[model samples]
Target: MPALPSFATFYPLNHHHSQGACQCGSPILSQFHERMMADISRRQFIGGAAGVMAMFAGLRAPRVLSQQPSDHNRPILLKNLRLFDGSGGPLREGVAIRIEDGRIQALLANGADSGNAEVVDCGGRVVMPGLIDAHWHTTLAGISQFEAMTADPGYVHLVAAKEAERTLMRGVTSVRDVGGPSFALKRAIDQGIVNGPRVFPAGAMISQTSGHGDFRMRHEVPRSADSPLSEQEKQGVAVIADGEAEVLRRTREQLMLGASQIKLMAGGGVASTYDPLDSTQFTERELRAAVDAAEDWGTYVAVHVYTPRGIQRSLRAGVKSIEHGQLADKESVRMMAGEGAWWSLQPFLQDEDSNVYPDAERQESQRMVAEGTVRAYEMAQHFDVKTAWGTDILFSPRNTQNQLRHLAKLTRFYDSLTTLAMATGRNGELLAMSGLRSTYQGKLGIIEPDALADLLVVDGSPEQGLDFLNDPKANLRLIMKGGRVYKNTL
Candidate 1:
């Protein structure tokens, strides 16, 4: 007879088990088998055995690209680039940038050595920080107001996801979503389940009854504590809170849900049917309540106000950002500058499609707001008020797709470099005003040592002419966010 196979070879047991299991039918072998079986659950033992077999058979687990870590830890050296560091000055030529571990490690002069890193020749292309949108509505992107009010939430979210991807591909790596159901989307992007920009979600825009955030139809009654919340309020896109107490509670609720900041309708809006553009919405006490709540949570409040009185009241209540100050006068602009508040202005093109309102009064209100855009920009600049640029593309799928075009329109008021700086460096500074409540850390919107690696390598210099931004697909040669390359045509 052939020699009996050893227990180690037959069963592939460890040394201790092998010593006592030479004979299969022996008492020692039986006891060893029982003990080994007891040491591991049946399911685990089976799975482990199968895995070992698969390994021996040259089988491997399927790879999930999104779940896998990105090239964040890898070192990359971009050489021979015209670097626009977002410092509001001339671009540096023949510079090299080294990125490692999701941060800019160094900026080198011409012919400087970068050892053992993956080198990319930029071919004298323009390198700048990824753009930032100070104000955006992520969940409302690509959806008309009517569609948003009538469409299913699932369908709306799908559309928002597609738009988010489009926004990122256009070189906008970060956005401050002032209103919408952005918390879930932000998590999805951060977890690598989706590809999009880093979102600073404001949770919901807190408004007074019939204010800008109230999307209720005419038949719908004013919201009360006893009444069921509207779909928009329930989804955390907007909340209608009436007195000071309600305002404080709603603001706190938003903060509880991870709102980076608070948004309040301090004045009437052009799109809202019940309020005139000049009508003040929230009372001073109510506005102060929201501001207090946000401040307690280490954040600040941004208010939608176009009129001088509305802007002045919000400023007195400690609102840090004043959005849509189109109807503001020079005195109001000076007051905003004195208060050190940011004027988040949108350049509404006169020839663009106007916002549709069922009420004739609301349509007139829209036109009035549109007519004040130029004056708003000029006044803000004249007063030396800190200003941030945003598209404010709400309720129009067509307009949402033209985000970069809207940014380019700022060139009418500023030079190309100044316009670019507003969208990148200046806007980034304003976004960080949330302080401890900010979602992202590390400096952004600039290509400097220790800043987050959100960069764009454009085919042409935007500082020379912002026309390159109009066609991002062809002009944006490379896009990298957090050291992960999203687009690389080169």
Candidate 2:
């Protein structure tokens, strides 16, 4: 392998203008300069870079949340709760949780004294770790296929903001956005400028030419040095890169932009017009390039794949997560289990509203993948593979509204407890696979001391009735994320 170039050289920081001014042209450099001038801390600089990138991309700039950390530092105490600690088991009764500085300080026994914290009487309400979606697309939220293809960039960001708030209010505290431009949204939420889940962004989906990430219209020519990029690429949602070198460079770009993980299109997909559902996309070498780049940054590559051939190639290339393995065979599933890679599966219902593809062929491919959902789950379970649930709800605003309902669909394969765990604890584990590239520190998806304070208080025990998750707005009495109360209806 060739020596990898530094990120600064890969993405030049300075652009010399005709007037002889050496201006820091890129968003990354401008953010770095601003941080230096403002004397911002390292953590704030990292998050502010994302907000700067969003501003450069034509979206409204997000306010930096570092200056107001005190706003979220207030101590909180919940008394008399039935706790589901995100570990699979019966709920513990009459427990109390004490939160301070955005971390859980203690899990006290019933009737514990609250000290100076703001106490809320739970009245035996069920408290659990906030929900997590291992696979999500924050940039694509609340937009239909038609709108995504034609909507203005500003309008799309506005829609994404609204969707982020909705996702949080529904009890989901975190999401690993597998594809799309989510860096801005992630920064906004982290800074408290937006009410939303913690986001682990995969800046853009890297794809082989004509692969799943290729949202080019039929009339548009294939991407080349002289040709302009597609709108999606321009928006930082996805990029078309081929071969080892290009793939490596694109992966590095996303890593530089603060991607927790890299998403690669390793196979054909239903929504893309050019690729067949069963066809493998990227070559093994190309996949390896992506993995190598991600590993260099202490993260991993996750591939969008559905078929056995694609799965086998990605697994062999050291991909850490496999998305949409609906068409994966038993052998591929076993291989994934042997490697301990995650199967980020989505429960696709045939009766549900699907992405509106331009042509009949694309729609047919969508149905084919949807029909294979059951077989994929069965294979994963048979092999005891690590599984995570997500509502890969894309390009359909109506379907996006059913994010929790999609998690509920997991009950078809596993029991209610197991299903709930998949969405919370197991998904949290998957997000942590980003390793050092992860943004937020401390444990998530569990009600334990030293864990990040993302809790949801439900009116009833979701362990016994997972359906309570389906109607989170009604059943959720309180929602706290990172020690800040976003909703309290008790």
Candidate 3:
């Protein structure tokens, strides 16, 4: 076996992925090295290389979120675009984007040019930051929505890879997977084992039994209540505990399992049948335990809540964000705002010809499908919440594309421009990332110099109407992520 690079040369964080390589010398060590380089983000790369690369700014960036072009040095120019920077701002017409080192080098105005770069004429089409959905769930089961809630990690990760591509087609280049079985699936996506969104995944969802992710049926598990899931089942996918101390242990356990963030079910969910959406299960101690554990680990916790009581406890715990607040009242919204936690809403439960269900289940779900979403939207808008686009696009027994039309319609909550930000810039901020608007560095959500090179060019400007963006069949002229052209035919 070849001698692999030193650990300090590779990462500063000691992000040891023992499952694969990172061992001093193993067979196929080069394969592990290749994956280590490909799998790591600029941030992770810097962490491993902290001492060696500290003199270089990008290598030692404090936030590790700087948009300084570090990939390659030459400039690549794009011309003739109508640009939306995703700051709830107006679009710029006839603009040009300059990129280098896989970062936006600059965004020139309509006739603006730096004069020393290669250019591709966009033919007056719209250019925007690649879309990003902050609250997406990739580990789901069934050939359709009706099949069931699960499959194995390998099966689901493979399935998720396909969904990730579909999202890119819709102009979304990055996504934050809210929860999954473990870090394995997210590691697969991030390491380029599969091609899809730039995934920031929260491995395994933490839950108290009867909370949102508790899948245990009393009749099924005859083992002790304290038996942790088998090695076959991990904390990353579906972990359930009972009391506060137990939940607290699971919280720390997940961080050890390669999680960069934490996810807790504060209450019930529409999908999980046991707990009512309004019931708040976690005590203040449990909430504090999760929050403290996450704080100690250098990450944030995103709580899943659908009702007021659940929302209240989540606030007490100081979670960073809330997902699918289908029944939050105005006070809860205001409280969330005061607490500085953002909201991620999926006003996308509706679509034409996209229904799936057993006859009776479908009929019962219809009532929930309609009322819960409508209320969620109304509260988000009324409270002036930091609500952004988080279409929980589930593709299994159901087509993910069908639900998007509602997101388009929901754009009426804010102006069309702000709505686009929900899908791009605002969503980036919700992910707790920095530098999304045009002027900042380490950009993720816009097209400009020194920004990430994720872009979507379409025939019609989505700002013209939600329909232009929502139509799955809409004419997308090109899709690029990190300067790689994944799709080009219009």
| Candidate 3 wrongly placed segments (more than 4 Å) | 1-74, 109-116, 145-157, 221-235, 348-369, 395-398, 403-406, 433-441, 472-474
Q: What is the C-alpha RMSD of each candidate to the true structure, in Å?
A: 18.2, 9.9, 11.1
Compared with the true structure, what per-residue lDDT tens digits does model 1 show for residues 91-149? 98978999888899999876887786777788889999999988776755566545544
Candidate 2 off by > 4 Å: 1-73, 146-152, 217-231, 353-364
Runs in model 1 with CA error above 4 Å?
Answer: 1-72, 145-152, 222-225, 353-360
Q: How far is candidate 3 from the true structure (C-alpha RMSD, Å)?
A: 11.1
Model 2 per-residue lDDT at 46: 57
Model 2 lDDT tens row, 82-175: 8888887778886789999889999887778888787878887888899998877675556654564454434556677777888888889998
Residue 266 deviation, candidate 2, in Å?
0.5
Model 3: residue 20 alpha-carbon error in angstroms: 38
